[model samples]
Target: MSARSIALDHLGGAEAAASLVSGQLDDLLIDTDLPRPGTIYRAIADRPVKGQGGMFVRTPDGPAFLRQVKGLAPGQPILVQVTGYAEPGKALPVTARLLFKSRYAIVTPEAPGLNLSRGIKDEDLRDSLLEIAHDALGGQEIGLILRSACADADPDAVAEDIRAMHDLARAVLADAAGQGPEKLVEGDGPHTLAWRDWVEPADVACRPGSFATLGVLDQVEALRRAEVALPGGGSCYIEPTRALVAVDVNTGGDTSPAAGLKANLAMARDLPRQLRLRGLGGQITLDLAPMPKKDRRAFETALRAAFRADPVETALAGWSPLGHFELQRKRDRLPLTDVM
Candidate 1:
């Protein structure tokens, strides 16, 4: 397995980067004041959308669209969680269902159940985690999910994490009935996110200037450009426009018959990390280097496997009639330019 590590330090406020010992930045998070996902807000309902069945709600950030809600009068209070980042100058996307996510546990108010991450397959470990969950939940009706990182973690530490998340969930739920528009919970910043999501075992450097020491600063600086160098001599340019994000694959100087296939496969596997680092999303069109139709299935399989491990929610919309591949990704992270 590739050795993973996280380097965290302040650039403007807070910045963190994850790398796989390949001298390339796998993920980058910069602290921005924008309302982040997983933040709960006690919002006041505004007018409903004409035909979308979603109601607009007033929030500290701006007007956030609350989905799947009905029968809302003007200026009614409701608790909602930010689902993801919204497009520029658009309504912030929100959902009625709230989930409190943390490093080792996730508290679900609506979904009542004790669950373990699917990656935790060891029966003995599962039993131990179940015991810990039962103790922390204290028979609460709310749900608790033990994340994969809890598999081999210290029992006490895991219990503490579970209790912390559970308490936060309870507190947020209690404030749901409060009056007017209010910010209930602030979202995690880059340093917090590094600890919560970069769960792989690795060295951590959190002191001042750790980013420079770990070469994370250099890797992050490269993300400002659109061109991404792929394995072998291949390259891809990731350009974001108002309408969509476009990628162009190039096979460089390789002249072999399988060169296109090789380059395209390399690009597919690395595209998720590139996008994650750069924080680009929404409609993506990939103009791949010319490859055989017979190899399309293999290329698709590679892309699917690559994205399966990515934390971002992306829909591989498949190939267009013009032979370009398409994807729709969530705007979970702000664009690097916006945050940098």
Candidate 2:
């Protein structure tokens, strides 16, 4: 068959992986409820590219795929692909093809109540179903990705699909419903990328190249607006927090008398904008580091004066003996991810 860029939406767990491979399924997509640090594609792709949901592996040989995942909780029945190629594009990694063939893609009443309704209860039901599928159905011990729209899916549509799937499942279940363990259970879906609009952050940049470089510049700008500057001439340390963030300043190489209070004040005054652009929230602390007593007092006075320019409930208490200035701001949401 000619290669096409097929994208599999809710391709559940390990068993699903096996089935797809057995059938020589095209591109796959996976989802995760929690942040994934590492993934399996690295262990299996023709060329794996990490994305938000999971890693994607593609080759001219076949299709790119995504996987679905839930946050790993304690004791959850884990569905790992039992057998597969150690390398990319291998046929049916595990399980027997004859067993999978006629019955490979059947669907059954997987967690009926869960599939039937809305709200948190449905979620619980779905999870329970996944457990049953794994423990009872020779299911490849995989889980499902429940979509938000499922809560609102039309009952008729859901029923129709479920019935069609259940029929197929009955056929498969006949020979091995409770027979020797199988590798997977086909999942439910009229899957599409429609909900991406709601979950993705509009402000966070996910460009192809160096967005990190832009992030660094943005951080420097925030500080500049706060009028924070180096003493001799170095850089600042900024720690982002969910509630607020802290910035530490170190004078680099300037050491000139003119670079004293004027520079420090400049850095302190300009930093807030950078905070906003970076979507930094929470309390902020500034440690100016040690300086000549005279320069310290001047820098402090200049900092207090700058706060008045765009005063927004931001308060800069004069430096502590440790040369730290503290700022507290109320936070309504989480902070940005990039570190400056």
Candidate 3:
């Protein structure tokens, strides 16, 4: 079993918690007062932005811009899902691609398929899960994707989750023709997000004040600072600005010939975890320590490997002309400074 342990407790809200791995702060999540991601809303198209090929929809929260669509009237109602956190004073990001996601299954309303997670490669196991999915779906046109968590999950539990998501999808889809804008399904809170996304086997502590008892709160305080301590006397500073997040790597007190390479590699490996904890995203520019061109491949490999395990979607935009690396990440949550 993994050494990861989850601490679920209240902090400034009804839903807030931290996740620890091997007794160290791995991730922190706090449900904010704003509308949560994945919330399904029956929205009315407000106006179409010229030349952008999109229209603004009056969501339950506020006006949301929907992309890649046409033939939208100002009063037409359509279903949209909250895509991610929006900048302050900006319209909430939303999309019409509605998804019903749970722990073991994800129900795609319009897409139709019975797909198993590729992580489960065993043919017999795949066949068994496929049978369960077929039985649960009962040949519905709605799409169902068995999550990776179902690989070793109990058959009955998986089936139940599938049926539940399927039913929810049907119910929500049925309400698309409603009269006015309304929230059909509220999104998952921080604690529910932890339970749903953190699928690795781990001990869970949900008693009151567990964050304080388990040192999660103390660890959280460190997030206020931009400097992240690295192994072997190295460190990196993450500072956010209006344009993008700037990360500068420093090999403190290490002057070896390979010092820059080592420090840069360490930063690349730990950068994803740090970003997740800090709840920072958008454009990221990394000013790595001075290293030879040949060493950048190693750093790039390490960076890619690090983010492969992160649940959030990130795009590595490659190195800039000035040797700085750039990345674009999803705004899944508010910045840690804003939350704390």
- Candidate order by decreasing TM-score: 3, 1, 2
Q: Write the per-residue lDDT of candidate 2 for residues 166-253, one digit (tens) a residue.
A: 4444554453323222323432221222122122112222232222322333332343343333434655666664444677666666
Overall lDDT per candidate, in order of appearance: 0.87, 0.37, 0.90
Cα displacement (angstroms), candidate 3, residue 72, comes to: 2.2
Question: How much is the lDDT of residue 185 in candidate 2?
Answer: 42
Q: Candidate 1 vs candidate 2: which has greater TM-score?
A: 1
For candidate 3, write residues 1-340 as lDDT tens digits. 5698898998776578778888899988887788999998999999998998899899768899899877779999999999998887778888888899999999987678788888998999999999999999887677889998998799999999999999998899889999989999999998888889888888899999999988988788888899999998999999999889999999999999999999999998899889999988999999999999999889999999999988889999999999999999999889988876
Q: Where does the lowest 10-residue lDDT sum fall in candidate 3?
A: 10-19
Question: Given candidate 1, what's the lDDT at residue 237?
Answer: 95
Pairs with steric clashes in candidate 3: none
Tens digits of per-residue lDDT for model 1 on 161-199?
999998998888888888878999988877788889888
> Which runs of model 1 end up more than 4 angstroms from their true locations?
none
Error of 2 at 139 (Å): 71
Among these predictions, the greatest lDDT belongs to: 3
Minimum summed lDDT over a 10-residue window in model 1 is located at 14-23
- Sort by lDDT, best first: what order? 3, 1, 2
**If both were scored by TM-score, which would come out higher, candidate 1 or candidate 3?**
3
Q: After superposition, how far is residue 162 of candidate 1 from its true place, in Å?
A: 1.7
